[model samples]
Structure formats: structure tokens, C-alpha cells
Target chain A: MVTVLFFAAAKEAAGMELLRLEVSQSLSLLQLQQRVLQLVPALQPLQSLLLWAVNNQYAVPAQVIESGDTVACFPPVSGG
Target chain B: MIQLTDQPLDYAAITESVRDPAAGAVVLFLGTVREFTAGQQTEQLEYEAYREMALASLQQLVQEAASMYPLVKVAVVHRLGVLQLTDVAVAIAVSTPHRAQAFAAGQWLIDTLKQRVPIWKREHYVDGRVQWQHPSQEAAVAPVVGEAS
Candidate 1:
């Protein structure tokens, strides 16, 4: 299972801070994004602007996301 | 030292934490909650972070800055939760053997953190409107600004 976290505007869009999704095996982040949207469609509007992280590190859509990892969805950072 | 906190930021403590006897200069930078954006009055701001990632990103920035400037010590703290205008929302401190190095490292740390950290800010205007501040989502949430609160 992958623990998916949402932060900032993305959290508001998703309407929850986080959720756990069961994954049969490792999948690419792009594929995971699709699966997540299937479960949380509210995030669709913000998809283009979202940033993704896997296991606390920035990852590309093609990067593998294994079960038991933590995936984060957020917008471009604006922290000082 | 790097952290994300819901409590008020103690910038003086952050600066002191990075002080090193062997370093000739220390530089500090604080990002405060501003009162205005454009002509609209800002009542306050709320900060949020993807905790684990934000902390890791801050540590990486410190390490990167150290590699670039020979930093003696570094501390960064970013405030989460609500903050009123003029409150310090973030603080970064670095000590180096020279003033130039310290200043350069301090600037780089703040600039890089803003771009790479997994933290976000929500602006609350005096008119009761709220907006989230992603670089591209500047106008995403709120209606047009009106008279101040």
C-alpha cells in the first residue's frame, strides 16, 4: 500500500490530508496519478499545476512508486 | 538545525544557533508576513507543509549552501499555521569565515527553499477573501479584491 499525502492547496482540493491506497506492486508515478484521480476526482482541476514526491523526494512521472512508499501531492512551493 | 513549527518564530535564537567562534560573520534572513499585496490589505497568512518532505528539503538546501560557500553553521525554521501581519514566517541563519560568504549562502538558502520546499502559504485579505499562493495559482481561489476590512 502507498500512503498518499496532500498538502497546501492540493489538500484543500483533495478534501483530505491523506489516504492509503492498496497497490498490487510497484507502478510508475504517472500511473499512480491516474489511479489516485479515479478515487479522488476533485483533484482533476489542479492536476496540471501539481507537483509530486515519492518517499519524501521529488520524483518525475516516470519514476517508480513501490508499495509501502509515501507519495505527496502539492503545488509549486512558495515558502520563504 | 532545521524545522517546521506552528509556534512563533524566534529569529534571534535561530541566528544564535548558527553562530560559530571561528566564523568572522553571520548573516540572518527573516521573511515576514506582509501587510499588503498589490493595493489590497492582508489580514494574515496561514502556512502548511508536507512535514517530512519540507524538513528534508530544508536540510538539503543547507547542505547545498554549505558546499557552495564554506558555511560554518546553518539554521532554518519555517513557521506553520496562522500568522498575523509583520510576524516572522521564516528565518535562515548562516555563519561563514567572511561576510561575503555568509551573505551569499543566506540568500541562496532562502531563494532555493522557496522554489523547492513542499510548503505553501494561504493569504487572508482584510476583506475576508482567501487565496492560496502557488506561483501559477495566484488568482485561482479568490474573487477580485475589494475595500479593506
Candidate 2:
């Protein structure tokens, strides 16, 4: 299971912090993004602009997630 | 000290930290809470952050600024919790040997911190509605140009 975390506007919009999902390691970041969009349809329009991080490191679209990795997706930060 | 504070900020203490004889120029940037957004009247703002993560990122940013310019010092403090209108929400100070580098480095620190740090703010409206300020999609991704320790 991988943990998905949210923050800021995404957290307020989703009304939650973390979610646990059981998925295979074959899932690429791109595919995982699509899965998130499926779960939170409101984020569909934001998919392209969202930034992702796996286990606290910035992630690229092609990166694959380990089963226990914590994945975070949120809008571009604005935290001066 | 570079920090993300949960209490009221002390501007004098922050300003004093930039004093250095080697620095002929010092620049300070303060971001304040405004009472209006778009057309609506704002009541207050609540800021939150992933504390440890935010602090780590801010420290990295300060180290990078120090190396990029001939800067003697760089500090950033962002306040969390409830903030009234006109309250100072964030402040950044950079000191360098020249005016140009100090100004540029100070601006870069504020702009880049907004883009890369993990802090968030929620605006409370007069009507009891609340909204989180989302990041603008149009902001330029100011490149991370220096080595961070």
C-alpha cells in the first residue's frame, strides 16, 4: 500500500490529509496521477499542473513507486 | 536565523541580524496581509505548514542564496496561525557587498520560497466562508541557481 498525502488548497478541497491505496509497483507516476484523478475527479483539471513527490523527494513522471512509499501531490507551492 | 514561525514576528530582531561591515547593502522584504482579495473583504488568514519539511527547505534556500551572491547573510521568517489584516506575514533580509546583488538575492529568495516551500494559507471572508489561496499557474519557475549545503 502506498500513502497519498495532500496539502493546502488540495487538502481543503479534498477535506483530508492522507489516503492509503493498495496498488502494484508497475504503476508509473503518470498512471498514479490518473488514478488520483479518477478518485478525486475535481483534480482532473489540475493534473497537468500538479507536482508529485515520492518518499519526500521530487518525482518525475516516469518514476515508479515502491509499495510503501508516501506519495504527495499538490499544486505548485506559494509559501513565501 | 531562517525560520517559519507560528507566532507574531519580531521585525527588529530580524533586521538586526543583517548587520555586517562587509556588506555595503542590505535589503529587507516584508509581505503583509491585505484586507481585500479580488472584490471580497477578508477577515483574517490562517497559515499552516509541514513544519520540519518547511524548515529544511527554507534552510536549503538560504544556503543557496549565500553562495549565489557575494552575500554576507540571508534570512527568511514566515508566520503561521491567525493573522489580522496589515499584519506582517513574512520577512526576508539579504546583505551583500553591492546594492544590485542584495536586491536581486532578496527578491529571488521571496519568489523562490513561495514556489518551493511547503506552507499554506487559508483566507477567511467576512461572510464566514473560507478559501485556500492556490498557487498561480503563470508564475515563472525561477530556477534554483546555487549550491545548497
Candidate 3:
């Protein structure tokens, strides 16, 4: 299983903070994002804007994502 | 000390924590929720973060700053949940051998944190409107429905 986490504006869009999906094999971040966007339609419009991370570290779209990894998605940060 | 707290920030305590006998200067920075922004009156502010990542990011930023500068010690605190106007949203404290270094490090930490950290802020306007802040946006607002609290 891969845990997908959302925060701030992305969380609002997803309607929940996190979800765990059963993944049979490893996938790229882009593939994972596509699968997530399909399940959470409210996040469709934010596809290009959401930032991605894996296992609590910032990640790129083409980065490899494995089962048991925690992936995070969020909008641009504005903290001080 | 790096922390993400839902409770109020004790800036003085944070500043005190970084005080060192070997360091000649200590700098404290408090990011407060202001009442106005470009003539728009903000009633309150709500802050949230990807907790684990946010904390890890803070630790990395501190290590990076320490390497770039001769930092003696550093402490950072960020508040989550709803905050009223004038509330302390974030606090950063740094100690260095000189005031200049302390000032420079403090500023860089805040600027970098604003851009890189996973924490987010939502502004509650006096007109009963609210929006999520994306610093890169040009007056754009992200509308929120359910309360995340």
C-alpha cells in the first residue's frame, strides 16, 4: 500500500488529509498522481500546481514511488 | 529546537533558548498575523502544514543555514490552527558571534522558509470572504469549503 497525503489547499480539494491505496508494484510519481487525480476529481484542476513529495521529502514527477512510501501533495507554500 | 505547535508561541522563551555565552549576539524574529494587506482587512488567519515534512524541512533549513554561516544555535517555532490578528504565527531565533551574522541568518531563514516550507496560511477577510495564500499568485485565491479543523 502507498499512502497519499494532502495538505492545505490540496487537502481541501481532496476532502481528506490522506488515503492509502493498494499498489501491486512500484510506480512513478506521475503515474501515482494520475491515479490519484482519477480517484479525487476535485483535484483535477490543481494537477499542474500541486507539489509532490515522497517519504516526507520533496519529489519530482518522474521520481520512482514504491509501495509503503508516503507521498504528499500540496499547493505553493506561504509560511514565514 | 524546531517545533510545529497549535498552541501560542513563546518567542521570548525561544529566543532565550538560543542564548549562548560564547555567542555575542542573538536575534529573534516573530512573524505575526497582521490586520491589513493591500487595503484588505484580514479578520483572522488559519495555518496548516504537512506536519512530518514541515518539521523535516525546518531541520534541513537550519542545517543549511548553519553550514553557510557560523551559527552558534538556532530555534524555530510555527503555530498551526486559527490565529487572530496580531497573533504570533512563527518565531525564529538564532545566535552568532556577531550581530550582522545573526541578522543575516535570521532573514535568510525566514525568506527561505516562506518559499520552501510545507506550511500554508489562509486569510479570513472582514467581508466574510476567505482564501488560501499562494505567494506566487497575483491576487489569486483558493476557495475552501469544509473546515479542516
Candidate 4:
């Protein structure tokens, strides 16, 4: 299980701040994104521009995520 | 390079921190919470962030700026939680061997961090309304005039 966190608009839209998804070691970020979309279809369109960070460092879509990782998903940053 | 605390930033201390015998110039920039945005009369602003990520991004921004300029040191600190109007939201300091690089690199780091960092600010209006200010996508990779970068 990996802890997934959402922030800003993503948090407001989903009405949730975090999620823990259970998947095998072979699962990649893309598959996790798909699983998140299944859980919250309203966020599907954000998949492309959104950024994924595993344990606070940025990661690519194909990166394999470890089970204990704390994964954070952020919308295209609207800061500054 | 260093960034610390969400409390009110001390500009003088930040400036002093980067002073060195070899450094000829230092540039300090502070972003304050303003009284208004668009048309709303903002009473306060609330800032939140994934703290660890925010710090990493800030460190990366300073490193990038240092590499691009002859800067001897850099420090960036951003506040979190509730902030009143006119409260300091962020502070950035850069010291370089020359004034030109100090000024230029200081501006660049602010711009890039504003565009790429995940910090969010929510505005509280005088009438009790609240709104989230979203950064423009087009300028995320480009500099916009008068942008708090």
C-alpha cells in the first residue's frame, strides 16, 4: 500500500486529502493514475498535466512505485 | 543556499546571512500579502504546501540560480498558515560577485519557483468570501511582468 496525497484544487474537488492504494510491486505510476481515475473519474482530465512525486521527489509516469512510498499528486502548480 | 520557517521573514537577517568578503552585491526580495487582488478586497491569505516538496523545490531553485550566475549564496523562506494583509509571504536573498548577476539571478529564481512550486494561497475577502488564486499556465515556463516570482 502506498499513501497518496492530493493538494489544492485536486483536494477541493475530490473532497479528500489522501488515499492509500494497494497494488503489486510491478504497478507503475500510470497504472496508479488509472486506478485513481477509476476512484474519482472527475479527475481524469487532470492526469496529463498533473505531476507525481514519490516521497517528495518528482517522478515520471513509468516509474515503479514501492509499496511503502508516500506518493503525492499535485495539479499543475498554480503558485506565485 | 537556505530557506527556513513560515513565520514572518526577517529581511535584514536574510541579507546579512549572504554577506561575504568576496561577494560584491546582494539582492533581497520580499513578497507581501497585498490588500487587493483583481477586484476583491482581501483581508487575509492562507498559504499551504506539501512542506517537504516545497523545501526541495526551493533548494533546487537556488541551486539552479547559483549555477547560472556567480552567486556565492542564496536563501529563500516562505510562510505558511494564516497571514494578514501586508504580511510577508516569502523572502529570497542572493549574493553574487557582481550586482548584475545578483539582481538577475534573484529575479529568475523567484519567477521559476512561483511557476513550479506547489504552494497554494487562498484569499479571504473583506466580505468573508474566499478564493484560490491559480497561477497562469502560459507563463509557467515564462516570466510575466510584475509577477511575484
Candidate 5:
């Protein structure tokens, strides 16, 4: 299972802070993102702008994700 | 010192922590909540962070600033949770052997922290509206639904 976390505006849109998905094999970040959009279509508009992180580091779309990895998605940060 | 705190930020303590005998200049920068933005009256701000990542990012930025400039010490503290207008939200202090380096490092620290840290702010307007502020290159998403005014 992969744990997907959301924050800030993304969390507000998705209506929850996190969710878990059962994955049988590894998938690219893009694939995971598509899966999330499938589940939460409200996030579709933010697909291009969403920032992804894998295990706490900024992630690229092509990054690989295994079952136990934790992925987070959020809008750009605006804090000082 | 790099920290994410729920308590009020103490700029004096942060400034004192970065004091060094070898340093001749110290610069402290505070980010406070303002009352208005683009003609809207803001009542308060709520801040949140991916705590672990935010702290790691801050520490990395401090190290980077120290290596990029001639500095003696650097400290950063960011507050989380709701804050009224004019409340201090973040504080940064840098000490260097000269005023130029101190000022430069302090500015860079705050600017870079805003861009790189995984912290966020939600503004509560006086007119029963709330919005999450977005950084440059991203649009503000939909308003928070199902939340009480």
C-alpha cells in the first residue's frame, strides 16, 4: 500500500488530509498522480501545478514509487 | 537555530542566540501578519507546515547561506497556528563580520525560506471569507468548502 498525503489548498479540495492505495507493483509518479485524479476529480484542474514529494524530497513526474513509499501533493508554498 | 514552533516567536531570543564576539553586525528580520491585502481586511492567518520537511529545508537553507557568505551564525524560527493581524509569524537572524554580509545573508534567508519551505498560510478575511495564499507560479485553488465562516 502507498500512502498519499495532501496539504493546504490541495487538502481542502480533496476533502481529506490523506489516503492509502493498494498497489500491486511499482508505478511512476505520473501514474500515481493520474490515479489520484481518478479518485478525486476535483484535483484535476491542479494536475499541472501540483507539487509532488516522495519520502519528503521533491519528486519529478518520472520518479518511481513502490508500495510502501509515502507521496505528498500540494500547491506551491507561500510562507516565510 | 532552526525551529517550527506553536508558541509565539521571540525575536529577542533568536537575536541573542546568534550573537558572537567575532561578529560586528547582526541583522534580524521579522515577518508579521498584516491587516489588509489588495483592499481586503484580514482578520487573522492560520499557518501550517509539513513539520519534518520544513525543518529539514530550513536547516539546509541556513547551511547554504553560511557557506555562500562570510557569516558567524544564523537562526530561523517560524510560528504555526492561528495569528491575529500584526503578529510575528517568522523571525530570522544572521550575524557576520560586516554589515553588508549580515544584511545580504538575512534577506536571502527569508526570501529563500518563503520559496523553498513547505509551510503555508490561510488568510481569514473580515467578510466571512477564507483563502489559501499561493506562491508564485501557482494559482490559488478553490475556496475551502464546508468550513464555517
Candidate 6:
């Protein structure tokens, strides 16, 4: 299972802060993102702008995800 | 030092933390909540972050700045949660052997933090409406100035 965390506007739009995905095999970050968007269509609009982090570091769509890894998604930051 | 806190920021303490004997210049930058944005009157602002990633990103930025510049000390503190107008949102201090490096490091730190950190801010207007301020979403919303409360 891979855990996906959401924050700020993403959390509000997702209606939950975290989701545990049951992955039968290894999946690429792009596939993971697609799965997440399927489950939470509210995130559709943010698909292109969402920033992904894998295991606490910035991740690209091609990054692979294994079971037990944590993924976090959020919109572009505006903090100073 | 890099931190994300829910409590109010102490600028004096932040400034003191970066004091170094080898450094001849120290630059402190504070980001405060403003009463207006694009002519809109803001009541309060709420900040949120993916804490774990935010901290890691902040530490990385400090290290990168140190390596790129001749900085002696660096510290950054960002406040989370609801904040009133004029409240300090973020504070950064950088000390270097020269004023030029210190100023450059300080500016780079704050600018990079705003772009890379996982923190987000929500603007609360007096009209009972709230808007999330993010780089990708800002252009879609029209500016609506609000009356002061």
C-alpha cells in the first residue's frame, strides 16, 4: 500500500487529507497520479499544476513508487 | 536553523541566532501579512504546509545558499495558522563576511522559500469570502477590493 497525503487547497478539494492505495505491483508516479485523480476527480483541475513529492523530496512523474512509500501532492506554494 | 511554527515569530531572536563573529554583515528579512492585495482588503490569512517536506526543502535551500555564497550563518522561521493583518509570516536572517553577499543570500532565501516550500496561504476578505493564493490559480481570479473591517 502506498500512502498519499494532501495539503492546503488540495486537501480541501480532495475532501480528505490522506489516502492509502493498494498497489498490487510497482507503479510509476504518472500511473499513481492517474489513480489518484480517478478516485478524487476534484483534483482533475489541478492535475497539471500539482507538485508531487515522494518520500519527502520533490518527485517527477517518471519516478517509480513501491509499496509503503509515501507521496504528497499540493498546489504551487505562495508562502514567503 | 530552519523551522515551521504555529506560534508568533520572534524577529529579535531570529536575528540574534545568526550573529557570528566572523561575519561583518547581517541581513534580516521579514514577510508580514498585509491589509490589502490588489486593492482588496484582507481580514486575516491562514497558512498551511506539508511540514515534513517543507522543512527538508528549507534546510536544502539554506545549504544551497551557503555553498553558493560566503555566508557565515543562516536561519529561517515561518509561521503557520491564522494570522491577522501585519503579523509576521516569515523571518529570515543571513550573515556573511560582506554586505553584498549577506543581502543576496537573504533575498534568495526568501524568494526560493516562497517558490519551493510546501506552504500555502489563504486570504480572508471582509466580504465573507476566502481565496487560496497559489501561483497557478492567481491569474484566474479577478481582483476584488474589500472594505476595511
Best-fitting candidate, scored by DockQ:
3
**lDDT per residue (tens digit) for residues A50-71 in model 2:** 6676665566779887688888
In model 5, the Cα lDDT at residue A70 comes to 91
Q: lDDT score, residue B145, model 1?
A: 17
Better of 2 and 3 by TM-score: 3
Q: Is the docking of candidate 5 incorrect, acceptable, medium or high quality?
A: acceptable
For all candidates, state DockQ relative to the true structure: 0.42, 0.43, 0.46, 0.38, 0.45, 0.44
Report the lDDT of model 5 for residue B79.
97
**Candidate 5's error at A28, in angstroms?**
1.2
RMSD of each: 7.3, 3.1, 5.6, 4.5, 6.3, 7.0
Model 6: colliding residue pairs: none
Judge the docking of candidate 3 as incorrect, acceptable, medium or high: acceptable
Docking class of 4: acceptable
**Highest TM-score model number:** 6
The candidates, ranked best first by DockQ, are: 3, 5, 6, 2, 1, 4
Span of 10 residues, lowest total lDDT, candidate 3 chain B:
B140-149
lDDT (tens digit, per residue) of candidate 3 on A1-80: 99999888899989999989999988899999999999999999877678788887777678888888999888988987
Per-candidate interface C-alpha RMSD?
10.7, 3.6, 8.8, 6.6, 9.4, 10.5
- Model 1: per-residue Cα lDDT over B88-148, one tens digit each: 9999889999999998888988887877887888899999999988874653322111211
Q: Tell me the tens digit of each residue's lDDT in model 4 across B92-143.
A: 8888888999999889988887776778888889999887666664333322
Ten-residue segment with the worst summed lDDT in candidate 1 chain B? B140-149
Off by over 4 Å in 1: B136-149
Choose 1 or 4, whichever is better by TM-score.
1
TM-score of each: 0.92, 0.83, 0.93, 0.87, 0.92, 0.93
Q: Which ten residues in a row have the lowest lDDT in candidate 2 chain A?
A: A49-58
Candidate 5, true inter-chain contacts retained: 0.59
